[model samples]
Target chain A: MTDARDGAGTAAPPSAREAYRDLLPALMRADDRLYCLDSDTGLFDRAAFAGVPDRYLNLGIAEHNLMGTAAGLAASGKIPFVTTMATFATTRALEAVKIDIAYPALPVRIVATHGGLAAGHLGPTHHALEDLAIMRMLPGFTVVVPGDARQAGEAVRQSVGLPGPVYIRLGRSATPDLDARAAGTGPSAGEPFEIGRAQWLRPPGDVALIAGGPHPVLAALRAADLLAAHGVRAAVLNLHTLRPLDADAVVAAAAGTAGVVTVEEHWRSGGLGGAVAETLAERAPARVARIGMPAAFAERVGGQDDLLGWYGITSGAIVAAALNLISGTPGGGTDDPDLSRV
Target chain B: MAGRAPGAPGDPPAADLPAVAHRVREHIVGMCAGPEGGHLGGSMSLVEILTVLYFAVMRIDPRRPAAPDRDILVLSKGHGAICLYAVLAERGFFPVAELAGYARPGGRLMGHPVRAVPGVEMPTGSLGHGLALTNGFALARRDRRCFTVLGDGELQEGSVWEAAMASAALGLGNLTAVVDRNALQITGPTEDAIGLEPLADRWRAFGWTVREVDGHDLGALHRALTQAETDGAPEAGRAGRERPVVVIARTVKGRGLPSVEGKVRGHYARLSERQAERSLAVLRARRRRAAP
Candidate 1:
């Protein structure tokens, strides 16, 4: 299902296709949202899930219907992901997510795509920035944001076997290249990913960089390079699972390091950063800086990079923030993790 | 009991009727006073309906709640859980005395129904969520039957309407919704909060076979539930032609205790010990009079 990219640079990055393609079969085989009364908006285009081997129902634009139906399917022993735009999943189907899936602890994985500003030019209504905050308020819901194709693939496969409710945020924008050699998913890539453990990208360092979903990985790369320039040696950690958070690993990393920097594309409240703070505040209290979306909705409309820059969610902003924290520049105001002003 | 023609409009034997209603009311009063707080009015309204479903109509085995073919029941407005808990207990889902734990800390019988409770099909308290669940259960096992009870006030939520539309579209004949229209909510009477006068028409428009019943009457409830089975008799034997059914049950807010029965403020009014004693006396008198 990989879309062959020709010389025209307008094609979506190959890495994103690679990530989505891996879960295509599994999602096709199981996702009941694919077979709802409506048709699936081809936003997550890869495999035409209909006519797939299993009952892969696509409930085309009805996010609420997808969520409610998925709950029923889960109650009946089927693993269903109520797939749709992140905005619709968060806004329209929020009641279903809160009541049907999370509160009841139904094991329905809300595999939301086009998270954050990934739905370029679709305007602010389609952009999903506060979904994490809204979802985290739920008691039993686990929020998972895969950093790359490998992580996304692993999350989908592993989530099928795990218990409880999960909200998986994916992207419509281009994804970063996967460290093919490091990820180790040649032909054996179909194996399930571990759900709650954070993948350590670098050896132990003075500053610990905790990242989740997609934007944080970009921040990790830049922050690592920036930290290297100052001899501050930073360790990058991919926190794919947001709830039932990798508390032990984060505590260990924060305790071992001088400071911690949490990066994400979600609002500062109830997202990866808040989760990390909750962990450290309980297990290992340390100086933690956060980089993520603000609480206010974006009035401007633009492409992925433009939206990220406007929200101070870009890798450069994260790198600068991380360096300032590491160098003790004492960021002008309260280091309260949820500093994003929308 | 094995295979009576469902929904044939008529009164059943009154001998068994008063006994079932008495048992249900006794359970409700005892449980509410024990807990000191409950959706007493709501539960009281649903007593006769629950009695009818558990004792007469629903094809359920108390020992095997998860039986492949067992009829399912979902309490959408789950705050009205006392009636369910009491009925399930009377039917032997668990020890009836456990009703004393209602709303207590660390109690299984919380203010709402939870799936953890052996016979409860789904965890509920949030309004307007049960119908969708009923739709799912029915659609999943098209071969089985399911029933869901919703409060009139709970129908104010848009989700219930969404579920109503979906179930009708799916042609889920095996699913039935029994709306306890007691005319009241936590605030005031339901019509004052949000008009549901066109409620029956709404369900019919949504493609359900609508039946209005005197919810407090055991005979009417049994008849309506039976009538639901033969709604579309031509395709009665067909696999999936059974359309969803909505039984709009007109009930008093509190059916047994005359002091609270039909009182708009009884939805959450705490029953005084004296009031509880009085209600128990009424139930006892009724039992004695109906003993023969």
Candidate 2:
């Protein structure tokens, strides 16, 4: 596992797909029971699986069968890593995943790509905005959204021994590597990443910016920088694991702060924002300003970054939301419906 | 009775099949009489299929249901879970007395078959997933055989066809699917809901070896299943005949009980105490008339 970051520390890291292509082959080779099942994703190179050709299978463009077959393999003592687009894996094959995998609590890892607005140019038909909510609701499911390529590899490696179904949401484009050591605060600042534990990228301050996925986490870091310029100290938390959430970290982050602001590349109602708010509502009361895609579908199509900016999921939007919460503004806590118009 | 433990290796004598099937049917009828009732029609239709698989066909051990190399049987049409429970109990997977607590509170047996039940390969109340699951089992260990019984009505799901295509494409010769072709679902006749005519041809088109048989005939079912198991063997693979097999078992819904036989109402019913006794009487009369 070579570091994707370069000496300059500004090199664009590999996308989640590239990380899987580099990581899965070795993982499969080390564990004979691990099989890779693809629904014609065409992401991994055939040469990479040359050693384990028999274990790698492309089930064609059938997500339903892909999931069901993975469940069957899991039940038979083989761990199957299923790969497909997020939309198809969640919506198209939802029933199969629920009944065949989640209901039985099988050990099938669904590493879905092009999550959220990653497939923005392909239009709404390809976007997977609702996948997190759907997968999180399934009983015995572990939902993890890796903030970068490195975390994606870690997620795939850690999920191999998990006893139940796991859903790993990934993106289609490259994202900057998120190194907590750069922030130089929190006890876990330099510790290795662990699933279900939040990574504190900055010291606790007046407000905490909580987010998951590649762009949102990076945006949260940038928002923390922007908040520093405004003389308001802000903490950035990479809440990669949605299920089995790090509620303790969330509650602690909200203890002395004005409130917490959540950012994600998904719908405002679910995903990281909903998970944060739901945890805080019961454990600790805090004002939350959720910055994400609105309830309506994308009215205009663009690249991943363009769509994120248009939907108010950028660092600037996060700064605005944090400032509003600090000032005790009433309507700033919820999603801004007017952002969808742009 | 054969002097061997239940689910012991080797097939029981052919003469014993009818008696075993008869007892299984009795168990189903009795269980359905419980307050919740069971999927009477589908369960009754599956009596011979389950009996033949558990008794004369598959390689399974009641004492070691999870043996690494043992054959697998998934009741894909999980509404017919009662038939599987009855057959498993009779085969010594569990005590037959446990059948009484089925669908009752605190009972391990639910309306759908789950892994909690012994000898059930996978929980499959949802239609259209069994074939794909069997494909997985077959692919995981090509040496062992895997089987699943799907309802004829379950063919309406597009996922079934998706699995059908995959089974053939993967050349999973160690896999066999038996369709309980009772030709009816809860809504009405399968044809009325969605016609699956030329069913055998459809399976053949999906690259499978199709064998249509009378589901009630123990001899035919036994033969079809045996041939399927043999055909799936790697050594039995001919030059161009390495294909998965589907045994279409044509059966009548609610076969033994004359009142609900071949009727829509037989799909599900809560039998009164009198109704249960009457149904058992009809089954006994049929057995007596068939005897020498």
Candidate 3:
């Protein structure tokens, strides 16, 4: 498998959490209604909030109260950005999000970090593999899984004027910057980033590889390059926004390609793959192969990259899925039924 | 009742609070008599608490419900939404006739409170969320006093304690919480469900100023709320009185309805027309007995 950093620059890309923290001070300056609430995630530096000490609050380890208080602030005409681990935010504080935030449609931005296997080494308890699925199912919620750090900042900025609750999923570690590399190559390249719009990183061709979150998207881009070497042109679609999903983009990608492959660091049942399959099943039917974690928790302890590789969430796995999808195979890539080594 | 003139709009005299509470209870019973039953027990218990807040304690205007500086009240124990609705209507936030539409199809009033109704600061039904929201309001605008009403049963929710810790840690002097200690829940007595016996001690432990009062005593409620506001005032902070206050108002779950008073069945009921009439008669008889 080709490393995502093979030909990339030496400087490491910023993690989505880092990008969000760096953007907080500016966001606070831009809008007086903006406030930051943390559930002791330790993702932010207290020094950045020195000038606006009252605005930045570390609410300790209570995610439930963190979300409810953010909703209350939003109800009082303040836009509160709540930070917590994705698993805790979605699972522990879910009812608070559904009632206090989504039910009233308050403008609370829940920027959850360590989405998917980003916290893999801490074991399955920390991994947020179900965050996207849980958030997307909520009504009046704008769910966004940024493909890179830059897109994460863009998602946070764009969520200000957007009425209602928003859930932004971020990875713990730095991932490749797919947007910078594909800036001038595709038709949708150089266009302004929108919350619900999908970005076409590679031109539509024989197969379409759609993905979201940092690693899955980078893997899709790399998979496109690998497919090109095998004379199999693959299009890459960065479907960042899960809810209020750009169905037109999904349908168009499916219509222009022989098959569609969805890759994500999530369960194959729900997340990005389930959304795309649901879209294509209704709008434009096509052969779809989903590349993601199977129906089991991580059995081995490892870093995010190790867990992803063990689960076949890699560029090589995406290439295999794309080839199998185009060849009309019954099962493709890492959509394996065997869970012996899960 | 004829000798007493109606008080001014926002600041009704403390003398008029009981009459206002009686009318609010009548409205709650009427709404509970509708096709869809309401939370009768909890709503009945909260009548005086909400009545005093809307008619006397809180500074709010029905015409300008969204005034930025206006004091806010969150009905955290949302099952008592009918009680809050009746108080809001009596305070002229909405028409009293609108109470008939409660819990009916296509009506804005659902089982719980929502922002669609005027004067409702936040939509709430799920327990343990109101205090945190109240903390948000207090934190956002330090000048305005914020209040919330919680059920003794609701204290079982862990988030309530979490909010309590945050409230004290932030020194939210402009925040007050009134616990409707009705001693009953949907299942049975609150103590049987989950004991909150040392409830005042719990709040004190959480670093809040605690006060226990008779929830049905409008004057006591009014005094406690006023003192809470004063204690939570910003100037009070300079005077070393910077803690949020909680009034644990001991109340009977079904205060107005004699048949279900303090019974678990009183938690929710869709009263028949006859039952509603008897309940009204009981309230009138009690008022007549207490009259001068």
Candidate 4:
């Protein structure tokens, strides 16, 4: 289902849309067992989710209403999945997420689509670069960014049965299939990966590498090859759940290796790196280098690769940052404040 | 407390309303005093309306609040919570003694009405949320039966307008929004805070069957409620449609207690024990004068 485009026009990824459609039946049939609250007429689009369906509610563009309603439904003993765009759900409906979902411990799976720069033409109004930062800040919220269509489906399936609040970010396009080598290996590859744990895609040694979000998986793979060529034995970590992060793994890797390199599509401050830094500081603080977009909104718009490179979140950038950090030399790109006090 | 039509002043001998109102007021005062904090003025304002709704208009079973057929009442102005707790307790939804725990630490009776509390429909301290939830309940019972009470001050929220538009479009006749036009909010007079003077005209413009009544007048209130019950006949019969009804009830910020009645400053003002005592005395005198 991967559609390789040499930097072109914007269209809904066939795989993403198909996954959403396929999941509709499971959502509807769950009945009182599963409840979904959405902004706009999310229910009207599918046959399964339609018109005041007993277990579902359409809050109509009111993101705050959607979160609060989802909380209310959860309070009434129903598993609620609140669907909305990442930009609006993270930035606009943030308070409701904090007070109602996280604070009250409502079991709501926030299925946020159009994550990062996937919202192409809509410009700054739709771009969700800060979502990871915002989401990972809240306590008890398990943040998951599926790398592709298969991961998205798996994440949704895993999230449905999970307890407490789950923030799932899905990409607009499909990526390459999950590497068969990584399957059935780690704890995450086994019977339903635990909520707060990270997956080690490659073993750690001289330098440690960490990435999050759908785009991060590709960057990690590419960066690993680059690091190997430079005679650096790099271990790649997929920081899927950002909030209740796998701090133990990150600290152990950082403590054993020369240094740690963190990368994400979110702002340098308050994103995945900030979360890891805070965790490590409290438990096992270490010398770490952060790699992400600088603190500024994206004004340029184009294809995913162009956006990635334009924001300096490319594999080459990650490779360079890793080299500098391991060599005990601060790269010019290392400008983000030390988040030890987060 | 169930079958009477709020007013039938002559039929039930006007005497019954005060007795019920007095009990409700007692519960309200006792609840707040226990916690040392509550919307005393707001609760006082709605004592008569709640009495009438429970005693006369609404068809609710004390044994079953969630029973599919029971009349639904949502108190959108959640700050005026004591009135609801008092009325529900008197109706035997829970032990009347539960009112004593209100607002106190280690009490099931929260400052706001939660679902655990019998007869309290939705959890709403937020002003705009209740009307929307009430719209859901009303639309659900489109076959016939549900009522929501919103505060005039709360109607200012934009979400209330959205719910109003949707309710009118859905034609939910089974739903009736009774706005306690007591004209007071936390800050001061509702008009001074946020004008809702043209509130009735606004509801009518939204395509609802509007009825204005003196909230304190048990007779007018009974007639209005009965009118709402009949209004759903045509819409429910139509199947694909329903019309929302709005009852604009004009009431004093503090109705029965002369010490606080019509006082804008008393919207959320606290009363000293002496003032509480005087207020109770005034209510007893009024009850005595109206009795026989």
What is candidate 3's TM-score for chain A?
A: 0.95
TM-score of chain B of each: 0.88, 0.92, 0.92, 0.87
Docking class of 1: acceptable
Measured against the true two-chain complex, the DockQ scores of the candidates, in the order shown, are 0.40, 0.78, 0.74, 0.17
Q: What is candidate 2's CA lDDT for residue A42? A: 83
A1-342, model 4: which lDDT tens digit per residue?
021221222323545435754675576585445766657734235456554266555667777656655664564456777788898899887866776577657687898888877766667787788898888778888898765566667777777777788998876665554444356533445334445677777776688788876566567666777788989988777777786777888886677777778888777888888877787778876767787767666565656666666666767777877888778886554544333311
RMSD after Cα superposition, model 1: 6.2
What lDDT tens digits, residue by residue, belong to model 4 across residues B200-242?
7787777777888998888888788776333543533335565
Query: Which portions of model 2 miss their true places by more than 4 Å?
Result: A1-11, A180-186, A332-336, A339-341, B1-15, B228-241
Candidate 3 structure, TM-score to reference: 0.94
In terms of lDDT, model 3 sits at 0.85
DockQ of 1: 0.40
Off by over 4 Å in 3: A1-11, A332-337, B1-15, B228-241
Instruction: Please give, for residues B1-292, the per-residue lDDT of candidate 3 as tens digits.
Output: 1112233434444457778787888888888899898899999999989988887878888878999999999999999999898888878777777888998899898889979999998888889999998988899899999999999999999999999998988888899999999998888988888899888888888888888899999889889989734444343233454789999999999897788889999888988899888888888788778764
TM-score of 4: 0.81
Candidate 1 to truth, TM:
0.86
Tell me the TM-score of each prediction against the true structure.
Answer: 0.86, 0.94, 0.94, 0.81
CAPRI tier for the interface of model 2: medium
lDDT of 2 by residue, A124-209 (tens): 99999999989888999999998778889999999998889999999987777777324466557777778889988887899999
Q: Find the 10 residues in a row with the least total lDDT in model 2 chain A.
A: A1-10
Q: Once model 2 is optimally superposed onto the true structure by TM-score, how far is the C-alpha of residue A162 displaced, in angstroms? A: 1.6
> Each candidate's iRMS in angstroms?
2.1, 0.7, 0.9, 4.4
